[model samples]
Target: MKRRPRRSVPATLTAVVLLAACAFVAVAAIQPIVGETPWVSYRSVADALHGARWTDLVPAIAGGVAALLGLVLLLTAILPGKLTVLPLLGELDSGASRRSYRSTLRAAVSTVDGVSAAKVKLKRRKVSVKVTTGRTSTGGLADAVRGALERRLDQIVPAVRPAVKVKVHAVRSAS
Candidate 1:
């Protein structure tokens, strides 16, 4: 089974910190509104726990939760997936034909001199490749994969641009 890439600890922590900051900002933004509402008030932590109506607290809590979720999504956009897999999205055709195309591309790329493994998916005219190369120069491997993919794509799907939407996953050897 293929394993997804592992996220760096600092990146994960940074995401958490950003989410917390977003939540803080959201809560701060909403605090004045909560204060204006008759149901909610700012009291000591002890008082808030004891007798504050659930209705009053719920909205603010919900807002905080929503903010946190939004921040999480924002962070997700910034961070790469943990696995060495690329998700192909957009107007590509579905069913076995696409899968076959992906598999064919993967096979072709894997046969290249330095590539150890390859996974491919197509979306619209774009092809996404996640390739692990045995070569030490990840950048060169990526370029080679792109070049090979373009050649194959010209023969298979001539309408697509070789450069426009090729998502390349370049893996480096651990020294």
Candidate 2:
């Protein structure tokens, strides 16, 4: 399934507040405007700047808040995310979650003939695969799993394909 990007919590909250403010203004002014006496005046950004003073307590607090907000935005933009959202076919973002991508990878690895089973783990920038197969086929099977997943990843997440690592182990049997 394709995933749609979600606006963050802050963004959603901002939208809600703006919508409420607009609605309140419209309701409050509707009667006055209909009676030919407009009741509200809008503040411009320039007005705020004109009133701002460095020594003023309110403006100083407001400026500090603005600076903190900017810092948060900068950090989030500069740092890499734990797991990247993969772009889907013809879509900007996938509707599926990271776990879905892991499952898809697990399926791809299991398709190999000798791979008895497969486990997939997704890390910050890597995908690790552990497969179980006979001792004699360990090396080749591990290589095959890695190769197959690498190709599948190209289709699943074309952007920033995480490094794929595969390991094989023989299942123990009680003698």
Candidate 3:
């Protein structure tokens, strides 16, 4: 069984924009037919569209904006987003929430020696570890943190193993 990533937020936003535009146009059209003042004049809109030439600046700008929007929407639909739930190594099809996974990895990293604080960020196929320590020297700390993270990951036994990248920062010693 394959787990699918969450829907693209840009795609959702695009859908919402399209829905709002359609609703606005429908309301404007219906108000004129129902003997009410429309927010936008349908006749004026038709005249503006008909009178505007493709070579005019206004029409050219509008066309460029529309084309850009379309391209963004197309890319959003085509790209795969980050997974909300990661697959676990189990026979019964179990999974773990991404938040929990990150927290677990953070805890494991924080337990390492000389690591004062740790932050873990999980991307599509990578784990970023940022560590802060007060030891003044950060040599080998990143590698140690990476090792701890890998050990924790091995214990958790997720179906896929992501590459780990660790960054360490050392605080000034109060000597």
Best by TM-score: 3
| Each prediction's whole-model lDDT (CA) | 0.62, 0.73, 0.86
Backbone clashes in each candidate structure, one number apiece?
A: 5, 3, 0
Candidate no. 3 TM-score: 0.81
**Local error of candidate 2 at 27, Å?**
41
- Candidate 1 local Cα displacement, residue 35, angstroms: 62
What residue pairs clash in candidate 2, if any at all? 2-95, 3-94, 3-95
Candidate with better TM-score, 1 vs 2: 2
**Candidate 3, 1-175: lDDT as tens digits:** 2456656577678779989999998998799789999898878889999999988999889889999988977777787666777988977788888889999999999899999998888987799999999897778898899899999989988888899999988887646
- As for model 3, its CA RMSD to the true structure in angstroms is 2.6
Give the winner by lDDT: 1 or 3: 3
- Tens-place lDDT per residue, model 2, 1-175, is 3343443755666678789999977876685667755454444545877888889999889889989977886675565555345545545544446778888999999899888888899875688988987556355787788889988977765555578888887785434
Give the Cα-based TM-score of candidate 2 against the true structure. Answer: 0.48
Q: How does each model score on TM-score?
A: 0.39, 0.48, 0.81
Q: Best candidate per lDDT, number?
A: 3
